[model samples]
Target: MADDKYYTLAEGCPFANNASAVLMRGKQGSGLGLLQDTQLIETLAHFSRERIPERVVHAKAVGSYGEFEATRDCSDFTSASFLNKVGKKTPVLQRVSTVGPESGSADTSRDVHGWAMKFYTDEGNQDFVFNNTPVFFIRDPLKFPSLNRSHKRHPQTHLPDANMFWDFHVGNPEGIHQLLILFSDRGTPKSVRYMHSYSGHTYKFTKPDGSFKYAKIHVKTQQGVENLSSQEATRIAGEDPDFMIRDMFEAIERGEYPTWNIYVQLMSPEEAENYKWNIFDMTKVWSHTEFPLQQIGRLTMNRNPQNYFADIEQAAFSPSTMVPGIAASADPVLQARLFAYPDAARYRLGVNYQQLPTNAAKAQVYCPFQRDGAMRFDDNYGGDPNYVGSWIKPTKFYQDAKGIRASALALHTDHEKWVGEVSAYTSEITDDDFVQPAALWEVLGRVSGQQDRVIENLVGSLTGVKYPELRRAVYSLFGRVNNNLGFMLQERTEAVIKTVQN
Candidate 1:
């Protein structure tokens, strides 16, 4: 093969034909000028056109090659080919990134970390686009753009604005649950491998008979969840911007592969209907006490990327990427992301993005209808009829046979109406919204000084609010979760502001 011997162009043309510019020989043997340099022109042109668009979110990332092995049999609830049998191993490409930061931004920023992994199962690809936090800021998909923009710079100042951050959250108090966690010590994770990942949206695990159970996946780091304090995070951001990335790379290089145990909190369809909290809400979590975790699999990241751009940069993941027996829930954010992620990939990586090696499925794909986009390298299904229901060339639909099987009554009740109810459900913020945050606060209290650290972390940012009224509103927001906690926040925040002014 040409690959084993020497270098070649994108076409199989050998590179020895044109290593340097074709030129007239000078006295000192320094080639004078280029007369014919097709390879030179090609190399320069390819280099110029090499860079594609960066991701809108999670631009700065470090990826690894891993494997997920099923530890338990889940065929009773899910018929997914990856999970049906015990000890089944599926190859995975995982990427960990920080949101709201540019590619050049510091890795230790106090921002939400994106946890994305692609599983190459026999059925197809299953992409889990998850986050470090179990809950999100809002359940409404429409507020997504505004919510992200607010976390970014101000329009006029072109700088991170505290007022803008507080304003957005105060206006949409529905995000309070996420905001509380965001301002806590958990916001600044020490390393990507040290932090846990959670699927904020509930998904479904369906059996062949269309019987299904709601599932929320949690990947707990075997290294254990560890975070840097506010001071430590700030210091690391300045000293080593790529601290987290470098740590992960070195760990793999040193043969210290990190692993996470994947568990799922599952609820039956009847239990979901009777549950106190809406199962579809992205802002709330199913309590551990109510729905305990059941172990499913384990993931170990043993290999680092050989080429960053090809392995990590070109990789695209979406919650919509599902195999048989695995499906998305009606969570508005998850539903929106199901469309938004692939749409962004199409815009950035071309319509044939899925054909890219990093994003391609290991399983055989026979879709003739989706063809002829830019950068398409396939043979366009080899003269098969693109139109469906063709008598001339009878096309086989392999996908239909792999999807969830159903009985007559199961199709109408759980399959049809359940989807309708989940999609039509609307979420609102009430006093009940504070329930989880209150529980979280109690959990922090058990750690003894953890709550104090969270208050201190929050006050440091809250005190930077330029407007007094804005600061008060922020205090009131926290106070609603706990009366004494709110009072402490106001007192400490005011004291910090006064000292800074003096």
Candidate 2:
């Protein structure tokens, strides 16, 4: 070990030739030395334990610190203190990620984009874990894990199987809405700064007295929605896997801060009852015409994190972590996620994951009973009882807003029957599913070479499907979207695969 050159136990050393130390001779038993054996064991030990557990989903991401300032008053919908006054500003930690991909996957991969934000409001932390797409693959929570698993590498093959991905979508036809969005150019965002974000899940804006209005949030990027073609995305993936991550870091460093216009779509409880589609359904979007977006605020990412792992990797967010004015909806997918997210953080980090610096709230969090777990950095609620129901120590409200008023509520009748069973109920392919997709197809056609590229990109995936039935199901699904699209896709796939084999 030299002073100038760092010491290596043969384990951490950057050796030019590791195999040179091994004893190889015709008559090794004559003069074998044990000194040469120690180096091999040390090298093997270090290599074995290098990896940690990967995230279940949304592993590939880029994050930033930003400020959200209210542009107008939204007091009618919710008594949330943050939105009560004009020009109110709150610090936000935003993370954008690609869903269903490994941490090493390309930023421009064809996948659903995540836009998870944690607002450090005065009341507490408000988490908005949303996707770039307005709608989701499935409305039911039961379909979630399966949907993610299908997108992941196949258990047996250890490869991304096309059959698995298409099977899940075709079987759960409700995914048709999101599947269309996925195949579109929007799937491959040009840059993290150039893409828009959305609050796909319907949340409620409530008042102090427990009354609320259903709302959906949108964060449109000021830079505009820019996308890379499939060829460009593939080239960048090969050239620079961390292209989007590096782009954001350099942009912020150069003081070209990215900003988003925040908008909300509000609907009263009375209106939801008569709405055409289920308001609680994550797969369905509230018609923009019916529930127009209203300007609310602006979010600008001005600062970069000092440390990537501490600030980004350790950050945890959940839709359940709502403040006074913001609350969860009865949406089945959202309701299920409320429990799943925090539980995931607990398992991934620890029971007291929130105690971590990035996840911790600015507001005082006093829960004595939840003390003393692995990595419990804080004092275990000194001199206080671990169990609840102590007469002397009464529980206190999380926030106290004197002037904040509760929202007006519509009449409520006990309709417990609506709370239905969770089953494998696929979506019916009505004409409605194709309407938006058709409009999108026309837009693609407007762009030179885009229609041909769309077909080429889709066929590249479709041709890899091993199962004939699954392939036809996919063709049939697209056929419902447009007869011409179905025929073109089938013809293109067959021809491309044939050329490769020949």
Candidate 3:
């Protein structure tokens, strides 16, 4: 019977033994082995290649399968077929991960979480690669790699250096708003299931008639936001490194799946033309009061992976995997990601990474030219013409789209050409950047002990800084946000540092 089966080789051939391999050796195993066994060689070779390259940032993650159901018609906003009709369901694969850790790092580490969703829609795969925080540390695309590297370990020490982290932030105080939020409770989410995700960069919702609007996506957790304190997170990180992943799996096994309500804040071209802040800035968030959230769909994660390595590990999500009617805004960071992410995946996986079952789109793709790469999957379009405009056996083309540019796919900027003097787009901190952060501080003050909690949390982490100058600069940066909060943070942090030093 199939149930009463014994183990065999990968090719289904019966093996000599399952536990051990036969090896010819000299007497008393003191001399070199003269003969080599095929099974032993194959087993050792396969074992050496068992691991794949891990993700650079979000190396530790948990994946789940789900379905997204459109709850409201968004036809007026965009022509994307996935959101045009209510109750339409699309299969989704999602992975939530800790951003700044290795493959074996703890899930409860105090870091931002990467929230990625891949929608296998009829039009193709659309990937929404988001983060738990709405804002980021930098607005300039060039500084992205530097900001991430600063958060990582040092080259000389080979360990995470707090002085390096604070040095970067001190030099670029424009990240003060994101820094404040990161040191708060929100940064240490208790579970991925209980946290919301936001598209940090502005995107586009395009219409068929070449009209488009700037939009930002937000997905609020239906389970509501929950967080672990820094101390608690540290304890769990040491006690059970896989606590969050285990909890999510156990919750799903008990039929309590996690869900999030998807919404988008849209800005008309006219409104964007007159907006106070740059609409394309990734470090800023549009006020919800001005642009209310328009609910579109719901995402529910119901199934865990059958095979972690195949279904979860090999899954790839990139900003370039966009479908029709949904385009990217001219946000510099976003434009950089559109080029960077897919390239990184090609390096990690093979060039034909998209052909993997977990990454392939459910929609029909007929690109014959993108072929003959490493790990080539599929039939290579199966005897179809690889080149275009073949006279002997010409490939049929869509007459409407052939040589005709899709006008709606173009980015919708206010002016068609350059109207202002060309200058470098650099990030500089001013009193204006502090306004939002000050408002956030006041809002936190309203809640009993929330301000204290944030201050305490900041003080605790600030103790990691060994350099007094860097610590002092950190205080000054927060001082720009608020006079009292910064002074208090300095006082408390210095006191703690002194105590530990003594």
Q: Which of 2 and 3 is the better model by lDDT?
A: 3
Instruction: After superposing candidate 1 on the true structure, give the runs of residues whose Cα lies further than 4 Å from its correct spot.
Output: 1-36, 390-414, 418-427
- TM-scores for all predictions: 0.90, 0.83, 0.93
Worst 10 residues of 3 by lDDT: 398-407
Error of 3 at 82 (Å): 1.0
Candidate 2 global CA lDDT score = 0.81
For residues 186-245, write the lDDT of model 1, one tens digit per residue.
899999889999999999988767688999999999998899988999999999999998
Alpha-carbon shift of residue 86 in model 2 (angstroms): 1.4
Spell out the clash pairs found in candidate 2. 207-406, 208-406
TM-score of 1: 0.90
Off by over 4 Å in 2: 1-52, 390-432, 442-449
lDDT of 2 at 25: 46
In candidate 1, the residue pairs with backbone N, CA or C atoms under 3 Å apart (3 or more residues apart, or in different chains) clash, namely: none
RMSD of each: 3.9, 7.0, 3.3
- Order of models, best TM-score first: 3, 1, 2
Candidate 3, position 358, lDDT: 96
